[model samples]
Target: MISSVLPTYNRAPLAFVKGAGSWLETADGTRYLDLGAGIAVNALGHAAPVLVEALTEQAHKVWHVSNLYQIPEQQKLADALVEKTFADTVFFTNSGTEACELAVKMARKYWYEKGAPERVEIITFRGAFHGRSSAAIAAAGSEKMVKGFGPVLPGFVHVDWLDLEAVKAAVSEKTCAIMLEPVQGEGGIRPAPDAFLTALKQISDETGTLLIFDEVQCGMGRTGRLFAHEWSGVTPDIMMVAKGIGGGFPLGAVLATEAAAAGMTAGTHGSTYGGNPLGCAVGAKVMEIVAEPEFLAAVNAKGGFLRQRLEGLVAAHPEIFEEVRGVGLMLGLKCRLAPGELVAAGYAERLLTVAAADNVLRILPALTITEEEMAEAVSRLDAAATALETHLA
Candidate 1:
């Protein structure tokens, strides 16, 4: 017997009736300290006042006018993105998957407009999770992602992670661009080495191949910077951003340099609900608060403090945790056992976490988490570890 809704996701039994700050409460009042932050979407935390105000205010004024007309809120978000990023132009979407689709189109179109239509292939790296879209799965080139979805989209070449020589050899006359995540969220919060990014940028410059960064999970102040790539001192020619950008609202964008976006003229791409007043208003508010230098510095400070605490946790529970990986608030704890074991243990302790590939548990708390909250979260994690050890013994 199938349920009313699709059973695609193996959802947790618990359901939250309300959320405040970093805490979510069930209907029966069981509260959980949320470290996943709705899978890193709620940057400012659950039910943030600023985002709420922005959403409701715009809801009262206007909602969807579509891309056929000029939208002030959309223009404001675009301007903010352009000012804060290397992108000269922006195209809004409803989710990161949509952004991936646009990024693929923009990359291939760039070559087509440059009279190099044959240069359609894009070089991607292993352990990269772009999205569930056909193009994104093809770019990942993973059997788990592309299996059963027969006849996968073509023109993507995969290589080993951080193998500069592999990337160098993979690039040919047919290569259009190289795409990767600065910090892979689903692939286990893997942060690329800064040196590797620098080398990739050099390769792009030499080969005229565009560098595309999927910052959907690591951008919008999650990495203690505006974006994760900033830490590498290398900017992407085309960037995909989402998640925290809208402070829990459905919003994503494809940011591109003028040269890269030249091919996407009028009618080349668009969306009906993208850049709607409601989403853009919330996104603008989120950007206003997150783009502050002081806010980002605080994130770095908290990230360091949290990492220090996590290192102690890993030391205390060598039987459970392997090591800690990642940067800023986007941290992951490699588990000695399957990460799902820790995830289920966290649930028993009323702690929320997300499990990923490579046997890692993602800890993506709100950027605005207080020091006291961090302590509590860690305490709960310790309790969960103890419980796991006892249950196993």
Candidate 2:
């Protein structure tokens, strides 16, 4: 362990030296079937030829230019995103946390512009993972994360997910918006009910509050669609996107309807590295590959297959896995054992999976993973479960 670096993350014992497609190779040449995909960032899988070629091609021509100048790549990516989604305007950031910060700022500023300066309270759900920024931490209201982090930011409220009555009761004259993850990723991979999302939209419309969807972990084809909200037929006033947007590179964005972004007229928000040429070029390439109709269809089919296999595993080992949850390739296995123990067992079996909130095992394979890789992941999972069951029994 590197003692110099902060011991913030509870990292696994092994270290991956390289990756290709759905596998990670350690220094000792041991290959592990990677289902987490760098926490769902590698949408195209590792070392995709197209992404490599595009990134390499752009590397020689130019890398970055200040956001002060015109960037054609940024415009192209933004135009493509706007064309496919309900967004009429867009802002770029370098990570999901920044995108989330922008979304929160935009929501409050929008209401302030409408002469409702008191409408600054933003309603967020109880198990939603927005990001790690101060504002995001405050919005999420996770006592575990917010503890000992000085005073929490003000004007944010938390409510029970999918409980319409609690949400209605929480909203007051000061409420400016409601934010949620369309498919909650860190919170045990629980997907918000379709009726609940639709109801939130209805309530937002009735109360004149903005609706923001944090699709950072679940968006960009992770859930077999450009955005998970599409599955529910609900369009958010402001949407935050990251993770798969840049493939393996770092990029995030906040897209919004025209009215919701009116307050962000020049100088309201800016980032030095946001929308630079290098990130934009790579992001454009990623968008080109993932935005295809056939690619999205394959993601859906693959996700269905993965879910079916996971359900079968649950049935076979009811003592280990309680339920399978989530949408598309972002599947989760509710476990009877401690999630960390399962992850450790998986590591010992040379399989890598992510642990999530609520003691669920997160299986977020690449959208481009093949059938054989899916089977291999399940096999390893079964082995790990059996090993743990023997120890526990």
Candidate 3:
């Protein structure tokens, strides 16, 4: 029988009625420590007081005013983004998927208007997960995402992230841009080497190919930086941001340099619900909190603490965990078995974790999570691993 709602998701049997900080509570008051953070969407944790206040205050004032009119809140967020990063302008969207859609169009359109319409192909990489949109799946070029969706959107060339030679070989005068994530979130938390990113920047500068980074998961204080690209000291011509940017309010944005965004004129792109006062209000609050120097430093310190703990955990459970990967709070446990087994075992321990490709179990807690919470999460993980090991034995 068909469910009332679409069954696209392999949803768990449990449901939470409320959440506070890094914990979720069922209707009967059984609490679970939330390390997944809604797949890295809840930046400030569940029902953060500041974000809740921002949303409610804006909700009381006004909710929706179409993009046809001026939106002061939107302007404030865009200005904040421009000031905090390499961007000169910003366009708001309702989700990361929408941001991906616009990034592709903006990059291609820049060349089309610059009298190079043939320069439309964008060089991408393997193990990349942009979004579920047609353009995003096309950019990934992975068979898992594009198998049934025949006639995938064209103009994307996939290559190996580590093979600088292959990346160079794939680039041509017809190449319009190079798009990739600084860290692969779904393909397992793999951070691109600094040299690889630097080489890509050189390629972009020399060939007039624009550089695009999908920082939806690794940005917004996740990688102990305002953006992960900062760690590599390389800046992309265009960047896509979402997930933690909204603090779970469903907001996304495309930040780009003026030249890159030149073709995205008034009518080039837009959305009815995008950049609404409510979403912008929440997004502005998130930026204000996350962009603070002290907050980010604390995030880095906490990340170090948690990572050290995870390293010890991995050493203690070598039979189950191969190693640890990722940066800041976006850490992953490379499981020896299917990652799903760890996720299920975590549920048994009343802890939440996310599973990803390449046999990894992702641990994406809120940036504000304290050291004590991290220790507790690690303890729970140890217990889960121990139980799984015992069951296997």
RMSD in Å for all candidates = 0.7, 1.1, 0.7
Local distance difference test values of all predictions, in order = 0.95, 0.91, 0.94
lDDT of 3 by residue, 70-114 (tens): 999999999999999999999999888999999999999999999
Clashes of 1: 0
Residue 331: error of model 3 in Å?
Answer: 0.5
lDDT (Cα, tens digit) per residue for candidate 2, span 196-292: 9999999999999899999999999988888999998999999999999999999999999999999998899999999978888889999998989
Could you tell which candidate, 1 or 2, scores higher by lDDT? Answer: 1
The clash number for model 2 is 0
Best-to-worst order by lDDT is 1, 3, 2
Candidate 1: the clashing residue pairs are none
Q: Model 2 compared with the native: what TM-score? A: 0.98
> What are the clash counts of all predictions, listed in order?
0, 0, 0
Estimate the lDDT of model 3: 0.94
Please, what are the lDDT tens digits per residue for candidate 1 over residues 324-391?
Answer: 99999999999999989888989989999999999999999999999999999999999999999998
Q: Which stretches of candidate 2 lie over 4 Å from their true place?
A: none
